[model samples]
Target: MSLNFKDGRSDLKRDSLMAEEQALPPSYSVQPPRQEAPEDLSARLARLDLRSSVKNGMNVSADQCTAHLKLLEAFNQLREDIGQIPGLFGIEDPIFENPETPDTHQHVQSPQALAKVRVAEKRWSVYVARAVARFEKWYSTCVPATMGGAPCNRLTGNQFCTVKGLDRVAYHGLPIKQLTLPDQLPPLDVLMVWHSYMLNPRCFFEDCFRYGKLDFFATALPWTAIDPYIDIVTFEFKPSVQAVENFETSTGLCWSNLNDGMEKTFSCPRCLSTISVPWTQGSLWTIANEMTPGNGFADGDFLAHCRVCDTKITHDYLRVLKFKADVQAFMSPSDTPLPGTLLNKDGQPGKLTVLGSPPESFFPNSLLNAGLSHRFLLLLDNPNVSMSDVRSIWEQGLTDKNLVHKAKGVRTRLLPKERLSIRRMMSRYWFNSSPFALDLAGAVIRQGSFVEKMHNIDWLHSPALKSTMERLVQKYQRFFTLMAENPGKVAVPTLDVDLAWHTHQLNPLEYYSYSDKMCYGKYIDHDDKIEETALSDAFTWTSKAYADKYGEPYSECTCWYCEAIRESHTSKLDRFFKPNKVQALEKLHGVEVPSDPLNSPHISAHNAVRDPESEAKQRVKAAELDKAYHKACAKAKKKGKPEPRRDDYFYYYAWGYPMYMPLYYPYGVPVVGGGGFYPADPCMVNTGAGSYGACAAGTCGGMAAAGGACGGGSGGCGGGCGGGGGCGGGGGCGGGGGGCGGGGGC
Candidate 1:
């Protein structure tokens, strides 16, 4: 019986069933029943309500419960449908997030991302538009009924509260009483629109003007930032005629007249014909021709034509006539009525009228000359020019011969001490006790040194010394006068005399310190011996001991002489020792002074008055020589030949001076030139032992000039005087009536 399980009966049943399924029609084989339409929503709801009832202290109904369940099921189905759509539900979906594939966690979009970003934008835009429209409508018309009846001003919260004269109440959590809106305020979404529109800077003023009076918010607007615009508009518009007239009337109080009945007279330079015209009836012209165009009352040249002769007259000449008229008006006011006045002091009728002339003419002259000093008046009038320039020009004018002679007369009449006292007073008062006075005092001190040594007199008390100082000052005054008179002349002799005077006063040893002197004096001849040991002993034993005992250094013994001396040292010592000074001094004094102490040629002082006449002759001769030399040089140049060498001999004799020495000298001599001391003469060569070589090349021009006399002739030997020879530098006789070979001791 078990063997029959694997039989044909099972196969036959399966085949029959398959044949039956295959033979049936597709629609008849598997058919779904049609679904009835859902019960009408209102009918269903009515039935649910009718079926619903409360029982057993519980208000429960099957129908109502069923309806609620159905509603919940429907809601769940709706949620499912929404979730099926892209970007609708779940953490995987997003509506506003970017659709682009993102790599970072923050920028990552949901897996169920949307393709339409503009759709979201459109939806938001629709919301904003609706909100704005609602807000605008409400703001335009809505006003709190509680406030006294008035039109809505469409103002901001704070402005609205202010206009209503009501205190604002708080809203939400923020205590914004100033901006607390009324209860009838629109929704926050709509209010946001109004806020944005009001706060926008571009539209703020425009909205204020359109919705409310701008005057109410004038204080709130930034007036300063817009003031330039306001000023532009104001200037562009013209004021009324009455306003202009009022302004003119108000400003006319200060006006005064210039022209009267008295006519101004003008004299033409060409015709020499005088013409009279009214002072104020002329036209002014600019000096630059291009400044004005066309011929009219305003167009003319600066020079005016004479009415009778038609001759051009300068404006300056016209101004002179105007000045005379003004003077006459001031003096005879009754006749002219002071140009502008209609009534005199006695209340009488006036002659003429002019505007803005009296103040312009009268004030300047009267105030400038109102008992003030010339310097003060100059400072007041010409503020641009400095006081020093004015003073210099003034002092130059004081060099007039008549003024100088008068000053000399006054000085010569006074006693020497009285003259000194006056000079000191003048130095202190007129010179303001300034550095200029100090320099003048220094010059006097240096000049006085010669007289002091000659007469063996104390500079402080000796009347002779004071007189000598006055004479030196007088010499400088004369020099200034000569310079002022003949400024264009070359080779001024007064300057040479000044240089000689300065040279005589110079002492080469004055600049060195005691230590330097002791070190360097070993190489030069000196009147006093200086030893290094002695200097060291003085510095160490005396200076330290004095400082330890007195608490201060001995300043006078070792310190610099004066500010002037220090300045001189810094300036360079060769300035005092120029060879020109040596030659000039020899010419003036008729004696030889050793230029270099190492070259101990017989040097002596002589008593000789400096002949100013001789110096003047020499200056004239030098100028002629210079002109002739330049003419010769120019002729040579024109002929395409080399320029001639300067005649050194002629220069020395004619200019009455020598050329500069070679800059280098002995160790003790200051190296004050461009490089160092240089011996100019071969005979004066430095021997290192402080001795100078003998003159193998004979005498220098300076020696010959010193020995020559004023008149051209040799002197005969008498009373220890040698025979005078011709001057060695090409012209003149020996100045001192002595020959080089004579026993009188050349």
Candidate 2:
């Protein structure tokens, strides 16, 4: 049952073969025959008189038959020669003439039979040895020219054989281009050759990085040959100008145009009074033109003296306030204002810009100009963070209003608390603590009071206040969850809230689906046309619906409502629900169900002269029966049993296997305490069984199968075949084999 490659028997066999060849007498010595050229052998095989020798049923020439008989004779001689060698094959047992009917044979063992078995085993060993020698010779010839005659030094992680020759080395059997080496190549040349070989046919190198073990090799051979040396050296390489330009084009934005001068509002540190400061757009220079005329300072070092209280406010404080300020009001017209604002210091309105009022009109282009797109892309690319989590942060940080407010508009009326409570209870299961806690459901319940107030209160409509509340709610939610999980050791979730805020401020649409909320249009009065052909081209290329809706050669439109509508129409649910729902309904009630279920002529003709109520009842009954039939079929398919007939429905439901809902943890915890979160049904929880006991009772079987077990568990986890206990038991939990607890045989 086991193969021992390190056994000394192979060494002994080699020694014996060498000794036998050496001891042979000069006349008895066997000489290898001269090899014939491939062409000559092919010609001889082609000339064979195969047709003449096929008189019977055998398709072979007389000469071939004669050669086969000779070969048999030689094989018998070889077996005899091997039998003469002592202890080559282990001791053999006697052979029975009738293996199937052992009782028919005599009880006495035959010495001759044992001898034959020993001879057979010896013959097998000799055959294997010869085959190995032939294969090795063929392999050496197949190796690359650079390593043809060289001894194999090592095997690479990718399984290629490596050999050194002169100053260079080659990997044999690897599907790479052969390097053209000089008679005397240096180490650097060898390195270059290897680099070229690794990169040959560009796609090869890409494939290696994407899906192969080429990343394992790092250094020059004979030094550190199992790691990626080139990658390590160039790991910190900066993007070239061309690369930057390519990135800009890909994102549909121009980096240089983001530097246009803009106005920013800053707050005084002492009195908390606000002031307007003119910034040289992307230059990082911030100074109040009226307060300190012609005095320019780095944004980081810029300080402002309060007009009333004479308090100096640093740029850092001002930056924080700036992000927290009301986006609309901060950019609104003001006396003694910044240059980028609609109104300058003299009270005259200024020119419109990308980052100005109605920022959503420019969309992705405006976002890129503000550097929000770059941040969002980076967050999206990170593996450690979840996209949903990043999206939540981005939405909160950037948006002026909550999603509900944006989607539904101003709510003039409010539902009573009692009515709202029932609706909330039906739709959402509110928890006291974080859902990530070990408990199946947390203790806290969301009263929806704050949400209701926000919905009804027209006075609480400041965009700044909404943005602030959004951030506070998110923070509070995360903090509550962390506190519940660790209690006394609560730690804030690691996140760059400020960065998320900046990203959101730049592009609110980054984290929202078009259907989720609509973007409000620009508020400014002026029309400053900035050509966005690239944006249009990108939108057209990326979205088929956009192209179709706008017509060919579509250009980016500044109409926010149109874009929002397009996005919402093409949302996830819009794309999938109609087709899937239709398919399911058709499979249940027949194809006619969709076009005209109530007034179909087919239904009317099928039940001719029947009353409308009776027909309706019959249709309902038929639908129920179809569902039951499908359910039975699906169950049979899963259990690998025969399908049940309609007549057997009662018997099947009463005595067949119990149907259980798939295990799930809505709170996100894989396991709570010592058990798993398994509800009685999909929506109802089983409060009687403890978490650990539920797992033991096989409730978390599906969870275990989905890699949700506490330890390394594979195989099925519950009642089906191959259901091994998720944590420690072997085989399936309730099956005919090595399961945790079952009535089946092992």
- Taking all chains together, each candidate's TM-score versus the true structure is 0.13, 0.14
Residues 612-700, candidate 2: write the lDDT tens digits. Answer: 22334435544543454465466446758544333311110000111111221011111101111111111112112222112222122
Q: Which stretches of candidate 2 lie over 4 Å from their true place?
A: 1-241, 245-324, 327-634, 637-746
**Candidate 1 lDDT, tens digit per residue, 103-212?**
33333222322212212222222233233334434443442211112222322322221222111110001111211222222333333343233211112222322233
Alpha-carbon RMSD, each predicted model: 52.9, 36.5
Candidate 1 residue runs with Cα over 4 Å from true position: 1-383, 387-746
Residue 125, model 1: Cα distance from true site in angstroms: 91
TM-score of 1: 0.13
Worst 10 residues of 1 by lDDT: 674-683
> Distance from true position, residue 511, model 1, in Å?
27
lDDT agreement with native, every candidate = 0.23, 0.22
